[model samples]
Target: MSEQSRGVTVTPQDDRYPGLVEGYNHRFTGRPEAVRLAATTQDVVDAVQDALDTGRRIAVRSGGHCFEDFTASPDIQVLIDLSPLAAVSYDERMAAFAVGGGTRLDHLYQELHDGWGVTVPAGTCFEVGVGGHICGGGYGHLSRRDGLVVDHLYAVEVVTVDDTGRARPVIATREPDDPHHDLWWAHTGGGGGNFGVVTRFWLRSAGPRPTAPEHALPRAPRRIRRADVVWSWDTLDEQSFTALLRAYTDWHEKNSAPDSPGRHIWSNLIVLHRSAGSFILNSVVDDDVPGAAELMAEQLAVLTGPGGAAPAHVEEQVVSWMDTWMPSYSWPSDPRGRYKNKAGYLRAGFTDHQLAAVHRHLTDPGYDNPMACLVLTGFGGQVNAVAPDATAVPQRDSILKASYSAGAWTAPEEDELHIAWVRRFYQDVYAETGGVPEPGDVNDGSYISYPDVDLADPVRNTSGTGWPVLYYKDNYPRLQRVKKRYDPRNVFRHALSVALPS
Candidate 1:
């Protein structure tokens, strides 16, 4: 390791290189020429400037939770590791919380709630880094009730290169009088690596500005009620499976209104491949709300209504928000298996054909991966209350978010098998539109957070709607302008980065 401008730089043969290059998904291997562990904003500035002057391809790694290899690409020569810049502090000048881009969701949640009794609606995965998650318009359990995490974003401090190729740090806020307002708007949902390196994110409530930190963001829930209802795959016949999906989709379509009671509840239906033994519906509701138990019961009834068979087991619990706020939040297993994932947004329920395709692929005995599954989580409600162009995130009218994923052996030899399995599964399900989920009645494009590079591949994405339209819709043009302005040199870019203006 060598000290460089207040940060540490290491080569592939260095002792820290192995740990620094390892990301959440073990499938990809990154062997950048140098890795810079930035301890502060200045360190990042210096590292970036050095890379720029030296003509090296730059990449950044925050939480390393990206499903794709944006940060782990082979073209990368310099990797800026922002994990050391993790800090959560109150900004008296802004009257809001200033969270370092490197801060993980778990630490940010704990500090914000414990220090000020406030929280930003964000992703469920605790290990996710704020750098990418917020920029991609992150949503989770509290989203339906409070809106998106970016909705609370007030400002961002980022490092950028000027027209003369001079690296500098700039802050952009939502204030009307702020000259960098466009820069701030771009970060709302423009996705990371397209503009610049975000060092800090200022979070506050969407409404009236508060003079104090305690009153800045929405108050954290007092307690949360959670339940896990499981159904054995062996006993779940096609009739029951079809019924279960219908009940789930029907309920979402009926209760997606901004004022619907379902807004207080959020759930994910994990339809794992048959090898998993059972499918589970894990849900959570605000325990402090009136009739909370009844709401959960209502959802359970719908879930089991189709099967008519009793759940193999039901586990229910109520705990303070702080106790189980970050459920299932854990570090990734070392030497994990190779993985591939795809995502789609739905404005309504799944079509009968789509449902049948799901059953057919999941029940197929040809390919095997117990960890493979299609997880559908209820969306909309408060999310749809915002206008389509309120921020860079335009998928405001969606009712559900579907994720198609598979995890298989880490051995290089098995990579093709798992990748093929997930690709074929997703393609067959969306055969009506194309290999990809085109924006339409059944699918409303894809989520940038769960990005799939295949969407940009012509052979893979037969969906007539190009990749940019699927993710940004009409917002793509605006994002391009921001890209041209902030990243003129395209110093920070990857496979799916926002494109520059033609």
Candidate 2:
């Protein structure tokens, strides 16, 4: 067998492979005994097939954004890094964009928006890879107006290893009647890298199309309202916190729909900065400036100031919605910046007491990180109106898809504490929202893209919710079937990957 690097290889590990490294994720890097940077579909297939034949564990990296170390873990000896396999092009016949799985989300945006004038309902972060990004039912600013990323996904090219340890690449389309129809469903939101190593994706036909003006995509929105409201941990008491949660919840329930005149031209970045030890409420809405700014000012005023305009970052923008969103957080239009992330979906908002609990957690300041922010993104509109069975992501009807994370910390020691804080916060705030999987009144089903390996571990995510069930919901079964069909030997097993049922 070919052996390279410091680790021993049971199978023939190509010592010449240059991509092998020690650390890989945005948060933690992974060192692999051998790393193969595949340039073609054949390479991906061979990597999978080799891992199966040699009884070696394998992990795939596209944008290195897997919240956990699933793809970037050191325990993973053989790594297949696909970030270099990226290539995007337009298909005249399909009228949809053919995007490589390795391509970054923002790169696709630049191609579709700047080159084509079209845009996909994708993640806000430009660096996120389209590979695993869309597979987890990706959502972005456009989600409220359009839908999640899967809503616009038309097809995918994937490589999976069967029980015989033979890797086969399959091209699955969203035809609904195709032989591999179930495979497409599994890819929609089943979580990437588990069922197969997807090489390319076909955007939906009826969805956004690239044009020259925007690049062939939908023209950027003309005017937008960028706003923010901050509350000190000391100021937001239990009653006020509850009122804030209720206010947001009520606003969403009262005005959610693609065609609603009161459509939210908004995004709330609920932040907890350990350094400052304060919570900043940031928002940006796409509504009639004069009308919405006033109406919204009132709705929020009840919970915030006595009256007057919103404080800090408060203003209505008349430029393109695309540009307006860029400066909301000084998040430049660049994807090269590396990031560490964790996300959660609120089936509902927090209760009054729960808000107070969160305030308390933020104030205690257990971890010190600059890029720390608990972003609360309101989700619900055309995306949620669809049924869970309809796509790979089932948390469609979520009232708020919140993202809890502490971005960059130079020291490895801080990772455990920050991550621990998010998980614990999720647990403490869960009871207020009822939590997930059950029908009664639950709202805490985590996002697969923002994977928390802790959820899969009995000791970490003691919430009793399993990985597949929490991430895929009822769709977990189909994902398992696909896993068995492609990766039967379980070569891709990771902390949070979908497993073939015993």
Candidate 3:
């Protein structure tokens, strides 16, 4: 191991090599020649320069929460770890909040809220790093009210490789006339590892620059009202289950308009397999909103209507926003467990046929994993107000996002079983679209934040539509142009990264 002002470089012979080779997901482990622990932006630049000079493959990792093997590929010769660069502060020069790309969501949220009483609409997973999250159009509980994280993104400081193979930092903003504006646009939702390494992000709401710190971003809610309702599998027959799902979907579809009263409400329905014993519906809303309690009760009533089964248990609480956000509500990462996740953007509620398929898969006796589940997350509202082409995220009109996932296994032998089950389940649900969610009236495609390699596989995604179309929709071409301009040598790429124009 060699230590320098830039950072520490751990070679294969170093003791740190073993720990740095693996990430959050235990499924993939890399055998890189060296690991560069970048402590500053200059460290990143030097690391990239070294890779370019040595003709070695390189990859970057922030919080190491990547779902796939993008950074953990075996072919990677040098891994640049940015976790050491974590920092969050307001940048008066840029009139925006400057967040280190390596900063975790939990750290970002606490700093923004405690320091300025503001926050961004990002993902619920607090461990997620801002580097990839913001670039992939991050969204969560506040999305329906404020819009996606990228919607408020002001500028990004990325280290790009020029045509001459020289690595340098470039600052790109949302300003239309800015020469590097396309670079900023591509990061909005084009996903990470496609353009270059993002060292810092400047965040401020769209519109005139705010003179005061408090006025720069959306105000953090004073308090939040949360409810978790669960229904036992025994009480849910096919009819009741289908009715419950339909009720939740219909309510969101009707109330997800930009100006709707229900915009303050955010919910997620986790439909676990029968082996899990019960399915759960978790909802939250700003307690400061008028009739917040009443709205919550009404939504519960709709889901547990006469036609559907009554909830077996319900838990409700009101807590300060800081209390709710801190300590990270996301499930702790299990180092031994492997995970697989597939996602799609829903333009509307699932049809009767789709609902039936969901029920069949959840109750299938052949599949007994309690960890297998499908999740429907509330979306739209202010998000849909943006034009599809306004940002790299083109599925702005989607009402809900569906995720099919399976995990909780420790043995590598169990990978095939769990993966096959989810693949079959997702395929069956979208059987009409050639085993995948193709951009259409009901399905707007998938979320890049929840990247799935299956979408790029011809045998799995028989939809004929390529992965680029499924994720970027009509924005793929523009992203490619941006890719060609910034990464002329394709220095940054991965399994599902943007392809150069033919």
lDDT on C-alpha atoms for all candidate structures: 0.86, 0.65, 0.89
Give per-residue CA lDDT, model 1, range 109-144, as digits (tens). Answer: 889888888888887777789999999998888888
Alpha-carbon lDDT of model 1: 0.86
Q: Which residue pairs in candidate 1 collide?
A: none
Taking the tens digit of each residue's C-alpha lDDT, what string does model 3 give over 436-476?
89988889899887889999998998989999999999999
lDDT value for model 2: 0.65
**Model 2 C-alpha lDDT per residue in residues 1-502, reported as the tens digit of each score:** 1223222222234544433442234455566666766777887887777766777778887776665677766677778877666777877765567887789876777677656556776776776778788887887776776677787777888887667767889988877688888888888888877777888888853435444233423344545665556655455544555566566666666656655534554566566654554555555555644476775565566445442223343444444555556544433322222345555666555655567656665555555565666677767776766788888787776767666665555556666776666566656655443332222254546788777665666665555667667677777777787777767877767777787877
Q: After superposing candidate 3, which stretches have Cα over 4 Å from the reference?
A: 1-6, 325-328
RMSD of 3: 1.7
Candidate 1 vs 2: which has more lDDT = 1
Q: Rank the candidates by TM-score, best first.
A: 3, 1, 2
* Model 2 error, position 482 (Å): 2.1
- What lDDT does candidate 3 reach at residue 232? 97
lDDT score, candidate 3, position 260? 87
